[model samples]
Target: MTKNISPPEALIYAMVTVSAADRAITTDELNRIGSIVRELPPFRAYTDDWLADAAQDCGKLLRKPHGVENVLDLVKATLTPELYETAYVLCAEVAASDLAVHHEEEKFLALLASNLEMDDLVCAALRRAARARHHQL
Candidate 1:
């Protein structure tokens, strides 16, 4: 039986997948994801333990053929137009949390931006914000 994830869960899974894209999900990335869930208003009702289940579901989806595309489809369906930017921002934060956007992570973000019809300028701004937040200096 296939388990379906809710919109909020989808958002969390998306972040998890991006962090895992580089094949090395750093401690910083996981901590950032956890913080987002714990502190964000949108995720107030979501429990912390659900992160693992969502991540595992995302892994299963990605293992299938055209999994990335499939995941994008899920994202589009789960998120409303107004919330699209929120999704992009969340994904960007995860991608940049480690202070380094790996090639795979960058590719995933680009695809996510395209899928969500996010404006390039907006994406640039979001990326800048994410980088700034994680900047050590």
Candidate 2:
């Protein structure tokens, strides 16, 4: 079942998914996600407490079945096309944070793209760009 989630909430969820893809969350990944959350335009007015609350909400959802779908839908519905594209780029960044993408990570990113109604070609491009970026890091 789908749940109602705001754009910012969805972005946080996306962050959670990327962070958890390896079955282990790293400090660098967490810090990167925190930075991304803080830089988002929708989160501009968020206080520290508010950001913490959102992070908690995302943490809860991560434990649910098909939770990623719900978050991607929220983001797809709420963000403009350009923003969604940006978010996809951000997802790539998150995936690359660990210096390598696992199979699970690739699947998760593909699923995220599907959830957002992005074309397969676009998803492939995103993956390629992400891998390239990771290699550069």
Candidate 3:
């Protein structure tokens, strides 16, 4: 049976996965993530307290072992196909933000796509976009 999940929760899960991909979350990355989160339509009307709460929740989840899969599952179960695709693209953007995509990050991204049941073609497109973004940096 499928589990129920919320869009806001799914987004937060995606962000948390990206943040933990590199094994260490840098301040710059965290700030960038915060900026991205603030700009998300779902969070458009969100106050500072709401953002903080989400970030804290993400942090708490990250502290647990092997939580990425759980997060990915939650996101996949909640998001519609279009939203999942968009989230994958956003994840690529976040992964490429540091000007380099670490091996672990790439693997994490692949795992995320797999968990979300995204097609290989779509994943490839997202990966290409991420590479393009990295080159532009």
Candidate 4:
């Protein structure tokens, strides 16, 4: 049911990568990812099945040695400038989905910011927003 699949799939893959980086994927993380695809403006046109396909594709990529860098490069290449921060924010949201950022997730976030070459201020703001939004209080 994936239609017109393209670079945006990289976005989903990025989220999935974050979810699995700790060697475990939580229900909250999975729900947050699904909600992102279903309700986020950027994904309004994206298909449900595309999420599964993207996640699976990312799993395969991570099985390789340099898959993390490779997948991030694909994301940086595909996302428009406007969407660059959006991708970072989505990753941040997934990172915070479990109520705390794991060490592995922190490393992935740093790597993502480095690869995206995001503005330091923008990255800080997105990180705060994602944490605030997902806070378990």
Task: Give one digit per residue, the lDDT tens place, for model 1 in 1-137.
Answer: 23566778878868977888888989999999999989998889877667777777888888888888888888888888888888889999999888889999999999999989989999999989988888886
Q: Quote the positional error of residue 52 for candidate 3 in Å.
A: 2.5
Runs in model 2 lying further than 4 Å from the true structure? 1-3, 134-137
Model number with the top lDDT: 1
Error at 15, model 1, angstroms: 0.5
Q: How good is model 1 by TM-score?
A: 0.93
lDDT of each: 0.86, 0.72, 0.73, 0.83
What is the Cα-based TM-score of model 2?
0.78
Mind sharing the TM-score for model 3?
0.82
lDDT (Cα, tens digit) per residue for candidate 2, span 1-137: 35676676667767677767778877767777777777878678667676678767866776788666656666677677766666776777787777877787778787777767788887778777867866752
Q: After superposing candidate 3 on the true structure, give the runs of residues whose Cα lies further than 4 Å from its correct spot.
A: 1-5, 134-137
**Backbone clashes in model 2, listed as residue pairs:** none
Q: Which whole-number lDDT from 0 to 100 does residue 123 have in model 3? A: 87
Q: What is the C-alpha lDDT profile of model 4 across 1-137, one tens digit per residue?
A: 11233656878978988888898999999999999899987777778897887888788888888888878877777777788888888989998988979999888888888888888888889989999997665
Overall local distance difference test of candidate 2: 0.72
